[model samples]
Target: MAPRLLLVEDDLHSRTAITLFLGDAGYAVDPCPDFASALRHLQNAQNDVPDYAAVLTDYNLGHRDLTGLSVCQAMRRTSNRKAPIIASSSEMKYWEEVADVFKLNLVPKLRHQWDGPAILAKLEEIGIKP
Candidate 1:
């Protein structure tokens, strides 16, 4: 079976694009549009463990209070804690915060660069083959 991935992106265009990209690259992506949905998926454990191989989230989740970093932190507390969490955002400011403090991987989302090469590379770097 293809590896499963959790994708949390608020922007519709980004979500669709990334989902399609990863799907084409042989991953089953569960795309979530907001923080709540992502958490719900993470908490919905199967056999007491979430089946996600990795998670990719945006920094700015369109919420004034919560960001993707919040999602990453939450994932660490879930049954899928060992799965890799990747923070993807055009907002360079929070990259260090996520990487340094939380030790999450980052894929810098450059505008008009939503193609999946960087993401795929990051996944490979972190030992996720897909």
Candidate 2:
């Protein structure tokens, strides 16, 4: 089966672009607009363990109380810590230390120069690929 991924982003355009891009790259993506919904999706998987090969979440999810970092932390706390969790944001450097603490991968926001190759490289760095 194609690798399944959880994609969380609040921006409609960015969300659509990433969903299409990853889907075209052959992943079965479960798209969510916020951390709460994404967490629910992760927690309520058919298997006790989520079947996702990886998770890609935007650093900011509107003005919510939680961010992608929170999602990564929760996943690590409840699920597999080794699974790849990537955070995307133009200001990713601001959260680099946090991501490092959680062992989450960091990728630039896709709206800029962060194209397919860039994301692919980040995924590969985290030991995930299309």
Candidate 3:
């Protein structure tokens, strides 16, 4: 079976592109537009069951309501946290904020230098196993 992945991104174009790419690369991508719904889904996953191999959360979810850092912290605090959380941030400063929230790694979305391959490989390195 294809590996399941949670993709939390607010931007339309980037979310679509990543969902298509990861799906084509043999992953089941669950795309979340913001953190509020993502948090709800994560809570449900912990309370019931989860079906994700990893979580790819965008740091800036447009507005201030649904920050990725909040989701990371919530996941860590839960009893049955089910996947490696990958935090993506455009600003390096946000890295520490989310890092303090969760024990996951961060990648800098530096213009055209966002290394998707490296991020995916690191996910594997960190025992995502998907």
Among the numbered candidates, top lDDT falls to 1
Candidate 3 segments whose C-alpha is farther than 4 A from its true place: 47-49, 79-82, 97-101, 112-114
Candidate with the greatest TM-score versus the true structure: 1
Report lDDT (CA) for all predictions.
Answer: 0.83, 0.75, 0.72
Lowest lDDT 10-mer window, candidate 1? 42-51
Q: Name the candidate, 1 or 3, with the larger TM-score value.
A: 1
lDDT of 1 by residue, 1-130 (tens): 8888999999999899999999998888999999999998998854465479998888889998888888888888887787888877777678676487777787788783454899999888888875
By TM-score, how accurate is candidate 2? 0.85
Q: What C-alpha lDDT does candidate 2 achieve relative to the native structure? A: 0.75
Provide the lDDT at 16 for model 1: 97
Flag the better candidate by TM-score, 1 or 2.
Answer: 1
If the candidates were sorted by their lDDT against the true structure, best first, what order would they fall in? 1, 2, 3
Q: State the lDDT at 99 in candidate 2.
A: 70
Q: Root-mean-square deviation of each candidate, in angstroms?
A: 1.7, 2.2, 2.4
Candidate 1, residue 14: lDDT: 89
> Tens-digit lDDT track for model 3 on 42-67?
77766876556788888788878657
Candidate 2 wrong stretches, greater than 4 Å:
46-50, 110-114
lDDT of 2 by residue, 16-68 (tens): 88778878877778889998888887786634745688888887888557988
